[model samples]
Target chain A: MDGFWIILSGTLIAISCGLLGAYLVLRKMAMVGDAISHAVLPGIVLAYLFSGSRETIPMLIGAAVLGVLTTVLIELFYKQARLQIDASIGITFTWLFAIGIILISVFAGQVDLDQDCVLYGEIAYVPLDLWFTASGINLGPRTVWIAATLLLLILTFIYFGRRGLFITTFNEEYAKALGLNVAFWHYALMGSVSLTTVVSFESVGAILVVAFLIVPPATAYLITTSLKPMLWLTAFFGFLSSLGGYFLAVWINGSIAGAMATVAGIFFLCVWIFSLIKQKQASIPFRA
Target chain B: MNDKTAIEAHNLTVSYNRRPVLWNVDFELPAGQVIGIIGPNGSGKTTLLKAIMDLVKKSSGYVKLFEQDLEEVRERISYVPQRESVDWDFPASVMDVVLMGRYRKNKLLKRLSKADRDLAAEALEKVNMLEYSNRQISQLSGGQQQRVFIARSLAQGADLYIMDEPFVGVDAATEEAIMLLMQEMKKEGKTVVVVHHDLQTAKLYFDWIVLLNTRLVASGPKDQIFNEALLQEAYGGKLNVLSKVGELIKEKDFPVREK
Candidate 1:
């Protein structure tokens, strides 16, 4: 029962991040998602310092604010300073992440937060943090409920904003000319990226969250030709990675999040190699 | 000609970082005509189209579409940006891209109706791309990509169509298809304006021409404006005097160029 619960929580985290990550990968903004996850570290530290607890709500709010700020600063560096996008993202997130690490070390004795936990979280302990009603009505683990709610929210955002997101992602200038309020859609996507990063990172930690955010979508992208199939494939790949990774962790007595990220990478490699072989086979007959 | 003016710009001046790109451009285009905006490289041709669509801010002057503000006539106008401006590798099919044309007609949350889907199909059929509706845009030839863009605008069903460099880097067949589509739209009493680079085809493709070299050299019927002198003025690469004056104006930090 404990193992099942842990894997279930991990799968939910993977699915939400994978779904949102598809759009980020499509838009060539995968690194931006990575940057947000790292930059939100300072937000997490600040929220803990102020609230003196690991409560999800205040931490989420803090992460969201930094996520938006990270995007704005990246844009400024890219546009105002005329730097390359990768450089801007590289500069902004690393600085924020470094600040977070410094803060954690400075208050090491006072806070329960550990630097190792920030890299790959202790999702095995997730079942221990159960939520119950005042009358002692158990409602499963808090991580399960939070991950489920985020999954629902991410799906709703994608469903309602599909058209605008599609148009903008494909051709921003065309969407702008059509009067689709391109900037609003841009910020809305950034907001979703922030929300996904905050919730998923809480369980999976920085490294695994970044892996899930990019690897599954990238794997899905290689095999699928259209957005609908790509989305479905991404979710499927996310589930496979989480399931395989959880068992691998159990077998090796290693980090579950690390195992999940490794599984996602393995899936991407398999698809890439398979696609290349198929392409070569298709060309062989024509050449002959 | 007493036909209604489709686009009117008066004393339009556009600049970037204190350097004027378009200087006091004034022109009027009649409705139901194929108008070509011809200019040399960096003559602000694309910039002009962008300004009219309100995609970019104009340094000065006013542009009215169909005798009204662009905001008031947005639905009546359809703009096709350069095909090279978009990433062809995006994960969207031909049908998905075409369906975007109907986005304005539906609310953000509402799904596109069946009627909208039918209209998108009809638009694709007009461009002979109906068979490729399910294909990914990345698998398309350059010509097919251009045709897809045209099909998207066709689905817009606007009274005026504005395209920027649609003929660049397309196959001969795609060029002919686009030309036929434009003629068909003109027959339907819809205005078509294109920013064209090839001067040879300008005579045959456009009914009217707006010759520009950072300034409105001439704008009129093809027979009148397509002559040798206007061509030289627009593309002779000897607008040194005008550029010199522009430089002086910029150096002086003048609010407006003394034309």
Candidate 2:
């Protein structure tokens, strides 16, 4: 039952990240997600410190606000300050994450969070934090419910905003000419990335969340020729990686988040090899 | 609201980082004619088109499309940006790309209707790209890609077509096909404005030419304004006497004023 709950939680997080990740990959903004996951660290830390509690709601609010701030800061640095994108992302996330680390270390005695857990999440501990009534009706872990709600929210956004996202990602100039608010779609996408990161950060940590946010969609990119297929394939790869990684962790007695990322990486490698072989086969007839 | 004028720009100026690229541009393009925007490198030809399309933030002055504000006439305008502007590796089929033209009419949150799909197909057929409708955009050749873009513009069903360097890097056959499509659009009483690079072919392709070089050098009918003096002014003496004569040779078949 513990294993079942853990895998379910991871899969939920994976699906949420995977759906949003397809758009990120399409827009070539995968690194933006990386930057947001890290930059939201300080916000999370500040929420914990100011509230004097490990409440999920406050931390999520902080992470969302900081996620938007990170995007705004990156834009300001690159557009107004004339910094390169890489430089902008680098400066913003590192400083913010450093502040988070310092705050955690400074208040180590009071804070239940640690730097190690921030890097590689504690999914194993997820089952311990149960949300139930006084009658002892089991409502499952808070992380599971959070991940499920986030996944639903992400899916809803994708369903309603599919055309807007498609047009914006495919061509911004055309989208602009069509009278669509390109900036709104852009920030809305970044908003989804933030929400997914914040909700998944507790289950999979910041670093591995980047993997779930990028790898599945990237793997889907190799196999699919269109956006719809890529999105469906991304969710499939995300679920497969989560389920496979969970069992692999059980067998090897390793970190679940790390093992899940490894599984995603392995899937990417397999797809790459398969594509290369297909290309070679097609070229052989021409050579002959 | 001048019914005869398709586009009118007055005192238009655009700059990048405070350095002016297009300066004091004034011109009026007539409706139902194929117009060419010709200029040398760094002459802000593309900038002028972007300004008219409202794609770039103009430093000064105003532009009117069909004698009204750009925002009001946006749906009536179709823009074919440079081929190199977008990523060809984008995961979308040719049909999908063309269907984007229908997005303006379909609007957000509304699925493209069956009529929209038929219009996309008919647009593709117009460009002879209907057979490759299902193919991914990345698999297309340079010329085929240009055709697909034209097909997309056709799907837009706009009154005015603004294309930037559409003929660049395309095969001669594709060039002819696009020219025929432009002429067909003209027959349908739609106006086309192209940013053309080749001075030799400019004479044959466009009936009206707007010579640009950081400003409006001259804009008028081909016979009225396609003269050596205007060319010299637009090119800024870069084409010396010999090259100027060479241009005469290239344009010899067409009766050009030697002055």
Candidate 3:
């Protein structure tokens, strides 16, 4: 049962991140997602200092504000300074992350936040945090409820904004000419990424979050040629990785989040190699 | 001609990186005509179309469609950017791309109705690509891809169509199909503005011409604008290569002299 809670939590994070990551990967903004995960550190630190606790709401608000700022700054450098997008992403995230580290050290006397907790979270401790009602109702682990709610929110966002996201993702200029508000969809996506990062951060940490944000979608992308199948495949792969990651962690006596990321990486490699083999087989007839 | 004007630009000046690309371009295209905006490389032909569609921020100028602001008549206009502008490797099928043409009509959060799908299918049939509707877009040939774009815009059912380099790399059949479609649209009292490069086909395909060399050298009926002097003024020394190859004729007597 404890293992069930942990896997469910990991799977929920996987599904949410994989769905959003599909669009990010297709937009060539996977690195942007990575940049946001790291840059939201300052927001997390600030939220902790202001709220005096690690409550989800204030931390989400903080992360959202900083996430939007990070995207805007990246765009500013890419457009105003004419810097390449990768360079812009690199420069912005590192600067914010450095500031976050500085804040942590300076407030070391007051804040109990440690860098290790923020960077590589321990998922095994998920069962320890349980949510209860005033009437003595036990709602299982709080992380389960949070992950489920986040998944529902992501589903609603994707469902309502499907066309807007699709058209803009496939072709922004065409969508803009048709009078669709491109900026709104762009910021909406960034905000959702920010919120998801912060939610997953406590259990999976930034490292595994980044892995879920990129690896599953990339793995799904290898076999599929359409968005619908790609999304379904991404979710399936996410669930599989979560399930496999737990037992692997137990067998090796390692970190569960690290094992999950490693399993996701292994899935990606297997898919890539299989695709190469298939491509070679298809060309054999042509060569003959 | 006593016809209504479809597109009117006044005092249009566009600059990139502080250098003027299109300066003081003034042209009024009459309704129901095939108009070609012709220019050499770096003459801002694409820039002019972008300005009309309001895709790029204008340094200075305004473009009116049917004597009204673009905002007032957005649904009446369809813009097909350069075929190379988007990634064909994007994970969408032929039917999916064409369905995007139906997007402007449906309100946000509303699924496309059955009528929209029918219109999309009808548009694909018009482009002779109905059979490929389920195929992934990446599997398409260059011509098939161009046809898909045209089919998408056709589904828009707009009064005005603006295209950038629609014929640059399409097969001859696709080119002919697009030409026929343009002619059909003209017969329906629709206006088309294309950024064209082929001078030989320009005279055959367009009724009106707007020649540019960073400025409006000429804009009028093709018979008036396709003359040697206007073309020489627009192409500048770029015609030297064409004359040296002597593909057509009259190299020695024209502006093809080495300079």
lDDT tens digits, residue span B48-130, model 2: 88888888999999999999998998888999988878888988999999998998634688888999999999999998999
Task: Give the winner by TM-score.
Answer: 3
Which is the winner by lDDT between candidate 1 and candidate 2? 2
Cα lDDT tens digits for candidate 1, A248-282:
99899898888988999999999999999999999
Better by DockQ, candidate 3 or 1: 3
Q: Rank the candidates by lDDT, best first.
A: 3, 2, 1
TM-score of 2: 0.93
Clashes of each: 0, 0, 0
Residue-wise C-alpha lDDT for candidate 2, range A44-120, written one tens digit per residue: 88888889777768887887899999988887898778888889888988888888888888888888876555434
How far in Å is the alpha carbon of A265 misplaced in model 1? Answer: 0.4
Relative to the unseen true structure, what is the Cα RMSD of model 2?
Answer: 4.9
Model 2: colliding residue pairs: none
DockQ of each: 0.54, 0.59, 0.63
Clashes of 1: 0
Model 3, B1-259: lDDT tens per residue? 2339999999999888889988988888899999999987779999998899898878898898889998988988999988888889888899999999999734967988999999999999999999999999988987899999989998999999999998877788999999998999999999999998789899999999999888999999999987788888998776877654663453233333311
- Candidate 3 residues lying further than 4 Å off, grouped into runs, are A52-57, A284-288, B1-3, B242-259
Per-residue lDDT for A187-229 in model 3, tens only? 8987888778778876777777888989999999888888989
